[model samples]
Target: MSNNSILLIDPNFDPANSANLSLLVKIGADTFSYVIIDQERKFVHAVYDEQECEDGYEKLKERLKNDTYLNLKYETVKIATHTQNVVYVPQELFNENEIALYTKFFADADSQNIYVQPSLQQNIYTVFSLPYSIEKIVNHNWQQSIKLEQNAGLLELAVQFDKETLIIDFTVGSFQFVYIKNNNIAFNQNYQFEDTEELTYFILLIVNQLNINMKQVAVNVCGIINDGDNKWSLLTQYFDKVEILTLVSDLDTTILDDMPAHYYTSLLALQTCG
Candidate 1:
């Protein structure tokens, strides 16, 4: 176990059945977390980095190397991240020649580093990027890599709710807001804030801009938030129905008894995507 990382392993994890394992990794600017599960959707092992590392990818790779269980081949691997260079493209307007369209919305698009994920809606797709070196590390370690998703928080939120709803996912120093209306995505964005007030202001701005009825739309929150936290209290004041997001019902939760299920909502949702 790494000094700065926390590991939780299910008592019944079977090393002999490594072939049934699937790994889900969530990499962020300063930290990373991963969960390993068996084919039955039962958690095998999980780890979270408590302190932010300047070289998070390197540190994570080192930890993975040292952990004997993690070295085994898994049935599938999925990686998700939050990157600024992401753009949503409608299938009708997207073409090879228009790859540069991402730059129109996000100024930092590197032509050589782009990746795309087709959405459940045939007409929509998402374009994003992962650092070349990090992508290489993931590829080298897990040859069965399934898909890499950018702004995965929003993607997870989009599929969880089908009606008019507001979803918020919180991380270390930032949070993501996703609004879904009429079984379609209305607005999706990420924001950084230093305190509860800044977060509140941003939410208000989005509500006004989208003309959302705060009273009518339900707000679902997940990630690093707790009921007693200031952000939770503040959100309750503006929205009549604010609730913490819940994990998919089919997943086994015996090993996660000590932690809030909402914290792993995004990782669980990744299993549903490509």
Candidate 2:
């Protein structure tokens, strides 16, 4: 199957679309294309399907003949593409800490590998892709580590008991979620969301259903929708404690504004562990 990915074309080039052209060479992606969506959602430039790849430098130059404005603005066409590729991770390559984190993350899923991500913008931990067998082992061990982290003040302590840790993620369109538990007792549920409004009611429903005090709860927000102050300030109405978390530091600022959040997250994740 063709991989689904997002491409970021050079802001300078109009017709060269050379950025996309170059990616086709490096990744050998099955399909290639570009869509320029303005604030008005108007198409400024575009190419799709078979027309995605370029013939050669000469041909690419010819295509940009009409892109005189871009010619004056930039020297070369640079583009960024987000594509999926089968990634492999040897079990022994990861430590018990990393494996434990993934186990708590995957819970009941069965997958060979896991995607370990740390967000630069939000500086939060994200674990994706895990096999069921490893997940159980990791989760089991994570509970033990969590007890240590909490006692050592590494984890949120206010709601470390029977209550749940409410996660309101505003990172992407569709958020991924998971519940971390301690035996039969469930202590936390991570709620991933593109924006708070989309799942605001659901959060309230859960709070009411669980009969949580909300004030004693901890809320973690990520992405552009919720700012450092707003992430905690607004949630203060419902949560006793609220904090903003990011896996990246100030040095990683460039990538945050330059790339899409998910792409940035994946790249940052790779960079940190590498």
Candidate 3:
């Protein structure tokens, strides 16, 4: 495990007999994480999260080579590869034939492995790119074609709550703010922030531009930030219904009782339905 990694595996989990289990993997520029779930029982068997690797890409590939649990056979394998070069196109506007036209907007398009994830419910297609080397590594291990998503777990929040909601998923230096209106994505983008003031400004600007009433909208936050952290503090001051993210599932993940509620939002969102 990396220096600041989090690992939790149930005592009863047996890697040798994982035919009924499901594997969920999340890879990013600086992190690699995976979760094992007993699909039949709706039980969480294992959760391994390692972040902030100095050589994240290389380290994760090495882990994929040596990690015991990761190589096991499972009912299915789902991966979420995070990338900033992503564009959302409405169903009517999406052109599968002209994919290169979309890549023209990305500076590193030539070096990326691109894939599209569609949301039939929302009627939009999320087109994203993953670095060729990393995507190849993922393909080598999973032995299956992978569907990559960038901040798409956030849409699960919109599905969970049928209200005016603003969901912010935070990382070290950036946050992806997704606002849901009329039960679909109205505004979605990532903003770089150095401090609470910068985050506050971005939220205020987006809210005003979208005519979202902070008092009426629900603000659910997750990831690196905590309940009383600077960013969360600032949000509570400006918003009325501010809350940390909760698992949108009925499964009894008793192990999570000791951990912070915000720790696994996007990671677990990879599996759980609204």
Which structure among the candidates has the greatest lDDT?
A: 3
List ranges where model 2 is wrong by over 4 Å: 1-164, 176-198, 209-211, 228-234, 248-253, 257-274
* lDDT of every model, 2 decimals: 0.72, 0.33, 0.75
Per-residue CA lDDT of model 1 for 68-160, tens digit only, reads 766777788887765666787767777866776665676454434677777665445777776666667777788668655545645655765
Find the candidate with the highest TM-score and give its number: 3
Worst 10 residues of 1 by lDDT: 47-56
- Estimate, for each residue in 1-274, the C-alpha lDDT of model 2 and write its tens digit: 1133344443443454323221111101222222232212222232111222322222223323543322322222222121121121233344536555445534354555544433222223434443344335434423221101000111222123343554443323332221223311223233333355746665676667766666665554433334434434546766777665343433323313543342222122221221
In model 3, the clashing pairs are none
Per-residue lDDT of 147 in model 2: 9
Return the TM-score for candidate 3, rounded to 2 decimals: 0.87
Positional deviation of 231 in candidate 1, in angstroms? 1.4
Model 1 spans > 4 angstroms off: 1-5, 40-59, 103-113, 153-157
Least accurate stretch of 10 residues (summed lDDT) in model 2?
Answer: 145-154
lDDT of 2: 0.33
